[model samples]
Target: MWDKERRSVATVFATHGAASGTFASRLPWLSDHLQLSAGKLGIALLMTSIGAITTMPFAGRAVARFGTGTVARTLICVNVAVLVAAAWMPSLLTLAACTIVMGAVAGTSDMAMNAQGILVEKRLGRSIMSGLHGTWSTGVLVAAMAGSLAAHQHIDARVHFAIAAAVLAVAVTWGTRSFRTTAADVGLAAEKKEDVPLFVIPRGVILLIGLVGFCGIYAEVASQDWSSVYMHRVLHGDEAEAAFTTGMFAFTMAAGRLSGDAVVGRLGAATTVRACGVLGALGGILVIAARSPLPAVAGFMLIGIGVSVVVPLAFAAAGHAGPNPTMGVAGVATIAYGAGMAAPGIIGGVADLTSLRVAFCAVAVLAGMVALGGGLLGRNAPAALHGAEPVRVAEAEVLATEG
Candidate 1:
């Protein structure tokens, strides 16, 4: 049963990852095919992000009522349908509209899968969230590679998305049955009959955690959506080199998450987060200040490594923060995601007004703030505050008996 559940979780992660990769990979082609100027493309892309933010809160409700399997399957189908529409659209406006729909589906799928992952982690009683996220990164890498290969072979973007959709469809079909039928409560409520609070406004510690996530996500989204363009246009790197920068970011992020559990266990979440934030800040600064493309690319790698563990740690903190873990998790995630969605447009506007390099420097400042915030947060919460009273108690008893 455990094996089956793990497999299902892995499948969902992979499917969502592939979908994200396909969307990202198709963007360059979409821009060229539609003859979109950079500013116009930026505005159009904002619609997709708006769609995601608008839909994510509702996705939480859907998961509460319909179950993760149903939500995942339905959203996956909707995503494919939207991709098809996007592929066939003749005008930039039409494509932008399709992008909005695609974003909605993608956002819903992300929430459902994350909710499912949290549940699975509870049942297994260990740290699986980072690993599940790593799988998503793996899928993104695979799709990016596939898209690159197909483009090199002179394959059309539509065909590439279609094939990617087919892969996701198969994954959804196979993993549908193993998804949890009931939502898993992570000791959030005292009674089984109590439904998880769907609309609690996060306060106190939850709010702080959400802010941490907001900063981290803002940095990450900026990198994901703009780093390639920055590399190509600002650094004068070739197409492949530009793509490699994004790939390197993704790769380092995945590597960080894959190894995060051990690091978190050894260093503790507070210390680890502080370190990551500092590293990310340094990386962002490096990207902004680098003289050559190689250093800029290396900066991306540093940012990836630094920001990798922030989200998972934030999520874990949210889960452990309040009595209703789901609501807390949802609140933080929703805020973080909303912030993430807005970041690109904000940065794009900044670039329009100033320069891309200056805009990235601003992002570096934000990343530095995040690091400072993490340190402050760590001081307030500490390891003793992470709901680990029993460990303290056990240690106390051992000391007393030994004495």
Candidate 2:
């Protein structure tokens, strides 16, 4: 059972990783094919983010009704189809439509997988969530490398996407059989009833954690989406160098997450979180103040390391807070993702009004706040107030006995 569960989680991670990789590789092709100006491209990308925000809450509900596995498989299929269509389509309207559809599917998959991970962590009786997320980072690494290779070989975006889709299809096939049904876990239902509020409101510690997550995700998104542009436009880097900047950030992030569990185990969540926040803030400051490309790239790497564990830690904290951890996680995730979508555009708008350098400096200020907020969160410890019955142990025992 454990093996099956492990494999199932791994498959989902791989699918997401591959898709992200393929998407990054295909962006240049997308730009060239559509002849999109930077402004137009930004607008189109914003639509995709809007689709994600619009669909994620609904996806959480779907996971509540249908099973995580069902939703995951369905969304993967949809993602593949939409991505393929988007790859082939040359028209801006068609591309926008396809990108929105892909975003919706991706959002659904994201919710379902995390909900599933929550369940899996309950069963395994230890911290597997970070490792699962690490797998996602690993997947992105592989995908980026693979996509770059394909591009270098002159493979068209359509062919690359088709290949990625094939890989996802195989993974989905293997994962579905081991997928847990909602009916399989009565305890989770009871817990949900107990933990979830009648009115969905973010308050107390959960709200604090969500805000922290918001800052972490905002920093991450900024680096992922804009670092390359910054390198190219501000630092006068070539396309290859710009791409390398993004890749290095992702690589370091993956490394941090892969090792995050150990750090958490050694330092405990409170201390680990505070330390990471400080590191991230410092990294952001360094990046903003950097005069040359090398320093900027180094700053991004530091940012990656600092922000790496924030999301997983936040999710774990959220799950531990409420009896119905899925609801808690979903709520926090919704806020965090919404923040992520808004970060780039907000930063871009600020950049347009002022300068890109100033915009990044603003981000640094926010990152410092995030770090301090994380420390404040540690001091308050709302996870304790949610009725400290050793939730992790109780949840694990329930899974073991139920299974």
Candidate 3:
């Protein structure tokens, strides 16, 4: 069985996932309610990316000052409230405003939870970050399916979102009760003295590791945005077939994440990430050359598995890479999340100029970059620097007793 702190953090991750998934699954209904065109809806959705990108640079400072638990609990409530408000928006302008707040809360909470996960992993003296992320993906899958069913039954968006908000709020309250409330509480007081910039930016080894994760995020976002389009337009697949390919990518990505920790333990983080990058690159090649829907589906699934653990592993690496884990994480995430926002435009623009196939060449090259930068995630620094040195037995005992 999982320990209290670990399970609690996992619940936080799950609820956050559900909150994000709810918006995506119910987007069509929101679009219909607002009477939005494809262009208008696209613009409204872009507000979310803008909000998240702008807010992420400051997330580390928030965590450093307030502690992960406080930041997470506060933001989870704010994020849920924002999502519920979005369900009631009477105009595109109102909904777009809600989305910006929704995105900022969601992104910052994401950073806080992962910071907590790093602490949990350190306490346990093992690799649990991947498993924590796997639970997040699972939460998304479950929530997406439920939202889809609610929409199919013509349930009111207000009712659905309200119910979701109430449930998540209650769950988060219970789950965060065990969270350690300060850096000193977790034996990380020394890390607080390290210089963390007011604005997060990748520098030194952190930049290199962030670049590796950036490639993975770029590929992941590109596939999520384009796999269905590629299936329908390129292979002339029917709607069901196109949806199936997209489903395949999502399913394999989730499955691979669930199993990633064990794989990391066996092969080590560097080798596993390197291999995953190679696999993603191969998958990209197959997608570019694929003439049939079947091949495209296979390729997308490969891409899914290939990129599944990259972000989790990257977060783990960044957590200990500098004197301040929170700022190190913020810096890496700024770069990596930028890739997520950029992938769609870059790929779409390239496809417009040439072809989608040619555009994916960028993804393939980025995947290869993951392999090249994989070595940067090698072993941690010394204990004095908050590296991956084994947690003192006494410190672990103190944590358990305090909980």
List TM-score per model, in order.
0.86, 0.85, 0.82
Number of the top candidate by TM-score?
Answer: 1
**Least accurate stretch of 10 residues (summed lDDT) in model 3?**
381-390
lDDT of 1 by residue, 241-353 (tens): 66566777778878888787666656666677778888888999999898889889888888887877777667666765544345656677677776576776777777788
Off by over 4 Å in 3: 27-42, 87-95, 151-159, 189-196, 225-247, 285-296, 344-362, 379-396, 399-403
**Deviating ranges (above 4 Å) for candidate 2:** 183-203, 375-403
Predicted candidate 3 versus true structure: per-residue lDDT over 204-251, tens digit per residue? 878888888889988886776567557766788754455456557767
Would you list the rank order by lDDT, best first? 3, 1, 2
> Candidate 2's residue-wise lDDT over 288-324, tens digit each?
8888999998988888887887777777777667665
List per-prediction Cα lDDT, in the order shown.
0.70, 0.69, 0.75
Task: List the candidates ranked by TM-score, beginning with the highest.
Answer: 1, 2, 3
Candidate 3 CA-lDDT value: 0.75
Name the candidate, 1 or 2, with the larger TM-score value. Answer: 1
Question: Candidate 2 — which pairs collide?
Answer: none
